[model samples]
Target: MEFPDGLVADTFARTWEMLLPSGTPGTAGLPARKLALAGPGLPDPGPAADIVLVPTHPQTGKAWQPPSGTAAVVPLSAEVWLHLAFPRDRLLVPATGGLPDGVLRDDPPPLHPAAPFRPDARIFFGTLARLPAVREPWLRTLHDHARHRFPHSFR
Candidate 1:
């Protein structure tokens, strides 16, 4: 998971911060003020994440996998990745869709986590850098996506 050079890594980090939906995706029950990214400025990028999300080959037609278990980060990452890979430009759902099936308890085990939080993505990106094949491209794509997600940070 080798990453692009330092420049690209920096770009990706900055973009991720910007583009990611502010606060936890579905943590609505909690107070809005408690959301990490709800403040005027970016929340302290949270703590260094240590979760390990397994990986799976993208389905032939689908780019993402279904959710698994009570917790899986892969599904969440896939949704965000699809948005980054295929943005609609307008305030609409991105052209790229997400995994069709959800991770089933009775079905075969998922290759990765179902839906990870932000810190998970950060750690995942760091690990992704170690792999040589998709390292730089992943970084570049993720960076672009991040920029699209958060233009304010780049400014």
Candidate 2:
């Protein structure tokens, strides 16, 4: 298991970050995000179309654990992922690194470990794209960040 060994171009990432709002369809600001670990003073990013940037690779089957350095963006909705993870489908939630102010959220709890978090935009992002409530352009920002800012390479 290898992580993103390449460094994403800072300038290019900054460019996309700035242009994120425009690329997104509705909102003008970044979406609410939280850490992926349960710690004192860590706040949930709310039940909206929140995001959790997590370890592209996880350390356990639980929902929240510390990251292994590299990040895989998980556009999670607390209300939805919780409902799904609470009962069945451990694969529903990705393992995250930590909470905001650095890495990412502590949602779904670490009770039910999962199959290591991997970046599956087609599965995760595609789910968000189909939702009407998550129409804020900020979602698009995340999408652009994944596609443009952090590409496999410059080519």
Model 1: lDDT equals 0.35
How well is each residue in 1-155 modelled by candidate 2, as lDDT tens digits? 11111221211233433445454323456643322322113344233212343222233433443234233335334433443333344443455632447544446554533643344446555665687745566556556566664455323
Ten contiguous residues minimizing lDDT sum, candidate 2: 1-10
Q: Number of clashing pairs, model 1?
A: 24
The TM-scores of all predictions, comma-separated, are 0.19, 0.27
At residue 118, give the lDDT of candidate 1.
Answer: 39
Each candidate: how many clashes? 24, 18
Candidate 1 residue lDDT tens string, 1-155? 21233332332444334433442322322212111111112222233221212222345433222232222233324334433333343332225753446733344532443543234445555555565643355344554455455455433
State residue 111's C-alpha deviation in candidate 1, in Å.
Answer: 23
